[model samples]
Target: MNRLYHVALSPFCRKVRLTLAEKKIEVELVEERYWDPSPDFLRRNPAGKVPVLRMDSRLMAESQAICEYLDETLPNPALIPADPEARYEVRRLCFWFDDKFNAEVTRPIMNERVWKKIRKEGYPDSRAVKSGLAAVKFHLDYMGWLLDQRRWLAGDVMTLADFAAAAHLSCLDYISDVDWNRSANVRDWYAKIKSRPAFRSLLADQLPGLPPSPQYALLDF
Candidate 1:
């Protein structure tokens, strides 16, 4: 059986999970404590990251690489466009969410609110939380602008870009950090994605000692 080493709330892990689910790949989920990296875990991924995937006589590290491999191997309901230009746009958006959005928002908030509690590594940083909260509004407005012009972030089709963006936002939503009402367009886009069969396992995730927000699992939310 395929298996994924992951932390329930990590956006990077969620991206891979979403991709796998979209392609209808069954995988055993194993929560890992990457901070206190074990030898076995390190052997799986020397980078000491969550979301090390073991499948088909192969071990994969890096979320994008794993997702792309899955996309190539399992082509049903393709997440990447065939057109070169369209594919470029999709990849660009994926990087924007995974790198820029993550650095500007996800990491700050998760490090403050969730990671601190899990690692027992001191208290939440109010300053970081405040900055993250402020930054998210800008992202939401930008998303709204994009959705107003396109059916999806990258194009008309729901691609890996949407999954990447939604993965980060969903983690924040679990912590009640996202303000859904900030943009109706963004909210509607998310609602559509959130209602997909691929999203069920994500909604079902329950991190020990960290209660999900009231609306985290609510489809109507």
Candidate 2:
């Protein structure tokens, strides 16, 4: 069986989990303390990232690489498009969320609201949290604009881009950090993604002392 070492609320980990679930791949989930990486974990991934996938006797790191490899090998429900231009669009949007969105919003907000509490480090920085909160409005508006033009984030069909965006947003939603009221388009798009069978595991995730927001698992919301 395939195995995945991950943290429950890491968007990068969630992205890989989403890809695996979307392709009907069953994987054993192992929670890893990435901040305190064990020697064995480091052996698996020198980078010490949470999402290290062990599949078919192979160890894979990097969510984007693993996801695209799966898309190439599985080929049933294609997450990346066939046309080169469309594929570029999908990859572009995936990076937009994973890189830009992460740096601007997820890292700052999660570092304050979630990680600080989890690590028992200290109180959250209001300025950093406020900055993250302030940044999300622009991201939401960008998503809304994309949704207005296309059925999904990349095109008419759902792609890894959508999963990438959802992965980040879902993590934020777990802590009630996302203002779903900001964009009807984004909210509706998330609702569609959230209701998928692939999303069940994410909705069911329990963060031990840190419980999810009340609406995190609610499909109607």
Candidate 3:
């Protein structure tokens, strides 16, 4: 059986999970404490990431690579676009979420609000959380602007870019950090994506002592 080593709230892991579910690939979910990696885990991924995937005889490390490989191997519901220009847009948006949005918002917020508590490292830093909250508004507005022109973030068809953006936002949503009312376009987009069959596993995830927000699992929210 295919297996995924992941933390419940990691956007990188969630991106891979979304891609796998979209492809209808069955995978065993294993929650890994990557901050304190074991020897075996380190051997699996020297980078010490949460989303180390073991499929058949292959072990995949990077989230984007794993997702792209899955899309390539299972082409029925293609997540990456075929056209080069369309593909470039998808990749661009994927990086915008995973790299830019993550750095500005997701990491700071999750680190302060979630990981610190989980790891017993320190108290939640209010200033960092506030900064993340402030930064997220800009991102939401940006997404709203994009949605104004296109059906999806990358194009008319749903793609990895949507999943990438959703992955990060979903994590924040779990913590009730996302103000869905801030952008009608983003809220409507999220509602549509959140209702997908591929999103069920993520909606069902429960972290010890850190339950999801009331609306996190609500399809109508």
Clashing pairs in 3: none
Tens digits of per-residue lDDT, candidate 2, 76-111, equal 799998999999999999999999999999999999
What lDDT would each prediction earn against the true structure? 0.94, 0.95, 0.94
What's the lDDT of the predicted structure labeled candidate 3? 0.94
Q: Is candidate 1 or candidate 3 better by lDDT?
A: 3
Q: In lDDT terms, which candidate is top?
A: 2
Q: Which stretches of candidate 1 lie over 4 Å from their true place?
A: none
Q: What's each prediction's TM-score? A: 0.98, 0.99, 0.99
Where in model 2 is the C-alpha error above 4 Å? Answer: none
Q: lDDT score, residue 190, model 1?
A: 95
Task: Sort by lDDT, best first.
Answer: 2, 3, 1
Candidate 1 lDDT, 125-200, residue by residue in tens: 8999999999999999999999999999998999999999999999999999999999999999999999999999
